[model samples]
Target: MNSSPPLSNLLRLAAAMIIITLSVYWMIFLRGLLVPILISVLLSILVSPITIQLEEKGLSKIASIILTIVLFLGLIAGIIYFATMQISDMLDVWPDLKRKGTLWFTQLQNWAYRLFGLRPQSQITKLQEMSMAFLSGGGSAALLKTTSTLADVILIPLYMFFMLYYRSFFCEFVYKVMAKSEKQRVNTVLFRICDVVHNYLSGLFIVMVIVGSLNTISLLILDINYAVFFGFFAALLLLIPYIGVLIGSLLPILMAFITKDSPMYGVGVAGAFLFIQFLEGNFITPYIVGSKISINPLVAIIGLLLGGVIWGIAGMMLSLPMIAILKVVFDHSESLKPFGYLIGEPVREESRRVVEEHTAENPELITDEVADSVKEAI
Candidate 1:
């Protein structure tokens, strides 16, 4: 018996893997350039309805777009100025903060030793040695990293401006190139994607602002230093999903521990975050975002991890929206609908069919004449 040839299949599989690897690498490597543009475009899309509304009110489209950009820029500038002042104040008291942190850690070590019958002094000594090594090498590296970050900060706004300016043309181009049957499908999917993204971003923004303001107020009440900085930092991180809340909550609690001289204050800070996130997830998000873009929690987590691996912070930030858009496309396509169903929220098809049948049985219910009756029955 002749054995089936295996080399060709192996070669094809190898080529496919290589192509996928290269595509991932390309996305990551070009993120430095593409990220700003992508962020700008997404922001523009989010705010486009406002721009259109302004135009309807008498302003030209170009004028409205320009006004929107300027307003956003001014808001950004104010935030930067406020955060800088707060951070500067924090830095000015850094030596005192460091001393307090060391004392707190020492106390924690002693407490742990007392409770667990472990040696605390040796662990503390090892920590000191590690800190010294980090200061000698990691500190300089961090400073260099900060410098590079500042450079990107300067570039992002410029990219945002140009992207917003050309947003209309880009949208038109997307619609223009598709065939008739494909065009309707593409347009429907695109509109749904845009709606979901816009709603999520806008709703999240509002939630963050409220949560951040609450955090700031709580910190101020507790007489914590850098309250504003921590509040804003938390708000920014709130743009990410489940992981963002943890990070946002941890930073403020740590700051409370370091600056307030009370472990209770740190606990209080964390408690406040937990409470706010609970309210937002259960109440605010449900009301504002509704059931539009529901995806499987497992898939969302996987997407976030994959995005982080591919594009670091920006990837993590954009991951959900990107997955959401993909879900929309998959849901609308016949071939890929099964994948979409796997990622989507559960729906009761039989219940929908029952409703349709009920509506068909009552002619007046199908019309506006029995709208109230239909609503009451439902």
Candidate 2:
């Protein structure tokens, strides 16, 4: 009888795992259509506060949606234009860059030979050949890829606008779908999710600006070319977790080594980025983004890697927010509350604050004895 129960439980667990795996695979397969919609949903959440503020200040729902989207698109357009200019400037010096790049490649080969007793030329040549084949050998494949990208660009904004416009209807639908007894708890979750997203985005912007400015100042002190662009570029790459900063720092260091008269400037670039990243990882992000999401670095990196495995780059981009949303959901459900607590930062005062807020919001949620018990526990 004991063996029978254990076997049954194992089978059930295996089935659940299979189902979850298949569901994720299906989502990835449907990403062509789903990614844009998902991106729009996230963008809508980020801009919801602005939409609400505009509505409060006398704009109609449609008008507010249009304005918010326009502003959002304008920012994107600005970035595109800036990047285009930078690319044009780069192309103007491509011949010089190509020569310098060849020199750097030779140095890299020598360094590899000295360090690993391996020739990098064959590997580099193979990579170059593969890249050329992928880019140039594709006729219909290239055309289809371009068409899909254009479609996504158009559809994402349209979806974002519609999502923003239908925000109220969506909320109503959510409320309607749940039981009356669960409505308060659902609303609480909704409010908390919004707060988390809004604060996370706001804090992200501030951190980016702060980091970018610091990078610019440091690069300026080192007399690096296009310091502003490189600074902001490094800051922007921070949107990707784990390996992003290193990749961002590599480009500027390479540029500094190739373009500057002294190789020491490259060292300075590396040092600057390392210090900035250390400050950001240790202090800026912890205090700002962590304050909103309350997710630790270890959990975030694991979630990011898992999401990337499931959904590729889109999965990685969505992972942190998705985890935060899951945490909110888990915390509210009695059965899942332990998982929620496991994901959250280890801070007892935060729980006490949450309890105090819960009591304030729903005063009759607990009896006097229960409240006293909570106080004592806190």
Winning candidate number (lDDT)? 2
Estimate the TM-score of every prediction. 0.80, 0.85
For 1-378, candidate 2 gives per-residue lDDT tens digits of: 344567878899999899998988888788788878877887889998899999999999999989999999999899889978987888899899889878877787888888887778776887798888877775437677678779999999899888888888998888988766488888988888887877777788788889888898999999987888888898987777766677778878988988876789999999999999999989998777766677756788898998788666667877888888888888788888888877877685477668878887888878778976885454
Q: What is the lDDT of residue 6 in candidate 1?
A: 89
Which residue segments of model 1 deviate by more than 4 Å?
A: 1-19, 57-62, 116-121, 128-148, 220-223, 259-262, 347-378
Q: After superposition, how far is residue 36 of candidate 1 from its true place, in Å?
A: 1.9
Query: Each candidate: RMSD to true structure?
Result: 4.9, 4.6
- C-alpha RMSD between model 1 and the true structure: 4.9
Backbone clashes in model 1, listed as residue pairs: none
**In model 1, what lDDT does residue 31 have?**
73
lDDT of 1 by residue, 248-301 (tens): 778778778877756899989888878877876788766665455677778888
Evaluate model 1: give its TM-score. 0.80
